[model samples]
Target: MPAEPPVDPMTDRELRADARRNREQVLATAQRLFAAQGLGIPLDEIARRAGVGPGTVHRHFPTKQALYLAVAIDQIRRLVDEGEALAATDDPAALFTLLSRMMASGAENAAVKSALTAAEFDLRDAAPDAAAGLTHQVARLLDRARQAGVVRDDVTVDEVMAIVAGAFAAIRHAGADTSPERSAHLARIILDGLRPPSRR
Candidate 1:
C-alpha cells in the first residue's frame, strides 16, 4: 500500500486506556488501508502502519472480514454520532442534513461496503445494536421533520433506510467514487423525494 500518515504513537497510559486507544488506532488505520488498497492488504501490514503489535490487530480482529465489518460498523457509529448531534438541534430540516451526511459517508466508504458484500457480511447482522441505534436516530429526526411539514408524513423508518440503500446503489451505478461533487448531486436528487411534495 502507498505510504500514508502513520498512526500516532501510543502514549504513556493505563492498560485499559492503552487497549482502547490501540484498538481505535487499528480501526482507523485499517479503515484507511482498506479504503486505499482494498481488503487484500495484509493484517501484519495494517498492524505495522497502525503502530500496534501484530497480535493486537489479530486479537481484536481474527480475520480480514472481521476488520472489514469493524470498519463498516465504525462508519455507522460515526453516522450515529452525526445523527445524535442533529437530533439535539432545533433545525426543522435536520432530517435532510442527517440523511445527506449518511449518503456522503456511504459514498466515501463504498469500497469497503462492496468488500463486505463480497464477503457476505451484512452490517445489520454483524452489528445490530449500532444499526438499530442509527435507525432510531434517523426515525427521531424524521418524526420531527414530518411534524414540521418538511418530510412527507407517509415515509416510514424502513423507507428511509431503503432510500439510503438506494442512494448507495445509485452512487455506485454512476461510478461517482472519484467525484465527490457528482456523488453529492446524486444524493440530493434521491433524498429530495423524502421531502413533502411542495418542499421537493
Candidate 2:
C-alpha cells in the first residue's frame, strides 16, 4: 500500500484563502481598536468592525489573550517586512525615515507598546521566533545605517532600541491634547542624535 505521499498535517489543515483574509482583517481591526480603546474590547465588537462573524473570529482566536498575542505577532511581522523593504533601499535617510515613521505611529498605538512592555503578555513566549526575527531585522537596519556613514559608527543596536523605547514611553505619557508636531519633533531629535558627530 502507498504511504499516501507522507501527508503533511500542517499543510493538510491549511486555512482557506478567505479564512486567512478574515483572520488578517480581524487582527488588524483588533490592533486598531485595542490601540485606540484598550484590551478590554469585546470579540463580538472586533468581529463586527472586521465585518466577519463572531464564530469566524473565535475560530481564528479562541480567546481574548489569544487574539492579543496574534495581534502582537502580526505587528512584529509587519516591522520585519518594513525593515526588509527599507534595507533593500540601502539608504540611511530612508532608514531614518522609517524610524521616524515608527515613532510617530507608535505614539498612537497602545497595542504595539503593550506587546513590548506588558509583563503579563510576554510576547517572547507568544512568538519567540517572530521576536528573534524582529531583532535581527532591526540590527540589520542599524548596521546598514552605520556602514553608510550616516549614523554614528559607535552606536549599537541596543542603544538605538533604547532610544526607540524611550520614544514609546514618551508617547504613552503624552496627553490627548498633544499635537502631532510634538512626536515628529521628538523623532527628529532622536534621529539627529544617531548621526555622526559634526566636524569642526
Candidate 3:
C-alpha cells in the first residue's frame, strides 16, 4: 500500500491570527452592508465589501444562517457588556432610561432587529452563552432595582423584555411618525408598572 502523506504540524498561534483577521473583516463588512441595505443584503456584496473572495467568505461563514448567527452572537455580547456598565448606575430610573434608549438604537439596526426576532425562534438552541450572559446581567439589574425599591418586586425580567420587544415592534410598525419621544413615553408607562409600591 502507498504510504499516506505525513500530516503537517499546525501552529495554534498562526491559525488563531488568521481566524481573527478573517472574523474581523467579515464582521466589519457585514456591519456596513447590513446598515446600508438591511438584513436582506446579499452575501456576495459582503464579500466584495470585505475585499475577500466569495470562497473565502463561505469558508468562514459556510451559510447565510451561520453569518447571521455570528452577527447576532456578537451583538448580544456587546449588549451584555453595555448592560453590565449600566448596571453600575445608582439611579434606577436613569438606568432604565439608558437601557431603553440602547434597545431603541439596537432596533434601528436591521441585522440586530432581525436577530432579535430570530432569537425568539430558538433562543435556547442558538447563542446560548450570549443569551445567558444577557439574562444574567438583566436579572442583576432588576434585582438591584427591586432591592432598592425602585422597581416593582412583582415584575419579572421576562416582563421587562416583553416591554422592550413591544417598543421595538411599535417603532418598526409605525412608518414616519415613530419619534424617540413616543418611545420614551411608552417606556415611562412600562416603567411605571415596574415601580415598587410606596412604603407609606
Question: Which candidate comes out best when scored by TM-score?
Answer: 1
Residue 161: error of model 1 in Å?
0.4
By TM-score, how accurate is candidate 2? 0.80
For model 1, how does the per-residue alpha-carbon lDDT over 7-92 read when each residue is reduced to its tens digit? 66765576679788899999999888876777789999999999988999999999887887888888888888999999999998
TM-score of decoy 1: 0.86
| Error in Å for residue 97 of model 2 | 2.4
Alpha-carbon TM-score of each model against the true structure: 0.86, 0.80, 0.77
Of 1 and 3, the candidate ahead on TM-score is 1
Ranking by TM-score: 1, 2, 3
lDDT of 3 by residue, 32-133 (tens): 676566668778888888888888788889987788767766776788888877887776654475457546555545556555555434444677777777
Candidate 1: which stretches are off by over 4 Å?
1-13, 111-119
Candidate 2 colliding pairs: none
Q: What is the lDDT for 98 in model 1?
A: 87
**Model 1, 3: alpha-carbon shift in Å?**
50
- Candidate 2 per-residue lDDT, tens place, 126-150, comes to 7888767766777888877777788
